[model samples]
Target: MVDTLQLILPGFLLPYLDRFMQFGQELFGGAWQDILTVVWTVIKVMLIIAPLLLGVAYTTFAERKVIGWMQVRIGPNRVGPWGLIQPLADGLKLLLKEVTIPSGADKFVFLIAPVFAFTPAVLAWAVIPFSDFLVLANVNASLLFIMAVTSISVYGIILAGWSSNSKYAFLGSMRSAAQMISYEVAMGLSLVVVLMISNSLNVVDIVQAQGQGRFADMGLNFLSWNWLPLLPMFVVYLVSIFAECGRAPFDLPEGESEIVGYHVEYAGMSFAVFQLAEYSAMILGTALISLLFLGGWSSPFGFLPDSAFWLFFKMFALLVVFFWARATFPRYRYDQVMRLGWKVFIPVCLVWLLIVGCWMMSPWNIWK
Candidate 1:
């Protein structure tokens, strides 16, 4: 991760980033380095966060528009040109709206639940590799960090449901928690094969590991990525992520036509926060898919330049898949969801893990 203020900005623009450091040293004496370190860290964090917020906002817009096109209907055309400003308009409305607390709700937990949900969505990005250059923390155990952080968001749903004191909300949350946990088992196992193959826990290392072999040298690098070698696990991971996000056919949590969602009692910006968490999770999930399964920031064809553009392109493509799945599939029954996770997805992942393990040890090991 580029940690310092000087490191994050282009060198040409701030050829004298060190001058600020020098000036700080002069002004604050021995404590100047510490002060500048804090300032630089804050700036770096903001650079990641500000764009993420905008991306999350626009993701919602893209979802609506894409789904609309799939269903042959126009979406979000009222705010700004072609509804480009719809997300901002929605945010402003939510900001000005009142946050209402239910009669028996626990005020503290109720108010904090949204934060619990939102924090993990943003925190996971700290270790995400955007391209060859951009990343925040660059933790060696980034894959584990992501799993640990993302797993916390479910608690927010549970808390929201319990705090609301509504039977429908509570039931919805329980179902969601069960569904999310079940799918996570499959998701984790699929990634086990990835780590086993890469022999590293760092997500970037996993991507770099893909950027090798004969296909890469032949300018057919897409053939060298993990997805081709680990096809079954790739499919498992994709489906597992869909369920993890509570999206599409897996979106029984938000089965508003039937069971009320966990955030049923939330209103105004409080409600908006939950929405933010959901979309952010979608973006995060798509990003991880791009990095882990597809090559992160690398061109599919070796002839093309590797850049952040490919990462964004892959992320956008995955988002289209999300919308496509939503448009194409009807909601799975709660029982069916459980069955798919436990009986289907889990077994598939487990069997693939064994196959991958054996394949890795064989003389014919492609990864070697």
Candidate 2:
């Protein structure tokens, strides 16, 4: 969205800013432009982060309402019009609450652990393309950056578990760590196949690459997207995202019926922060799935103009599936989860990666 203030503000503001820039340069004899650039960069980042925070908040509302409908029950309808403002109310409650540290707990790490988890969810957005020009950091190695940054969140889980000074919390963290690591291997391999086909780490280039081929030429662009050609890897990535985000069936880390999660000792907003991190990561996972497989911001049909609406719509569709799966499936046994990740997903991804690589090298190559 364009900044409304740019149009509303006085016409003389630009010249005034220029005069202030010159005055600062004369006084400090240094890079006033760089300082302005930094300030502007911070503003752009805030634009990204502010919406993301709202998205994360509403995701919980969506999940609850979706699951409630599936289970034949009314969800949070008392807070606002059809419970639209429920997330906002919840945020207010969390903010007004207190942070509690358990006795004998490592206070510093206990406090900092949520930051480790939360920062990564926010960091991944830096490279996520909402539209052609609507990204904070459109770097060359954006895909690599996503993989690397997302991997760090598990450490936060482990630290939260350990620093809480509770055995159950530690056990939960261990489960989360192992689960995330195992799934990362399969997910990474699947993305590698995409990299082979697209031949670029830049997220924009990957999406643009999907906007071609016979189907896109025919104006059935959805058919041209990677989800069709990379069906198996697409499945792998989807299932891996569920496990990675610790959603149901794969949510062994926090078997709420049996064991508390890594943040068991946390209370009030401190606990809410961990939850914020989790749902933020869930949003990130959905965004990644939409981008890597569903063609990012591309329109479903060719005649429609590509926009952020398509990307957000696709993300919402995938998120409904995330909630549907959570409602439909039961939690897996921890051992079963491990077996699937290692014995099934890993080998499958590896084999599929090999097959895709070989196919690309064959005379039948269509991606070229």
Q: Enumerate clash totals for all models, in the order shown.
A: 0, 0
* Local accuracy of candidate 1 as per-residue lDDT tens digits, 20-137: 6567678889997677668767877999899999999998999999999988999999999999999999999999999999989999999999999899989999899987668878
Indicate the residue-level lDDT of 200 in model 2.
98
lDDT of 2 by residue, 112-132 (tens): 998998999899888898887
Stretches of model 1 off by over 4 angstroms after superposition: 1-22
State the weakest 10-residue window (summed lDDT) of model 1: 1-10
Deviation in Å, model 1, residue 142 alpha carbon: 1.0
Q: List per-prediction Cα lDDT, in the order shown.
A: 0.90, 0.89
Error of 1 at 312 (Å): 0.8
Residue pairs clashing, model 1: none
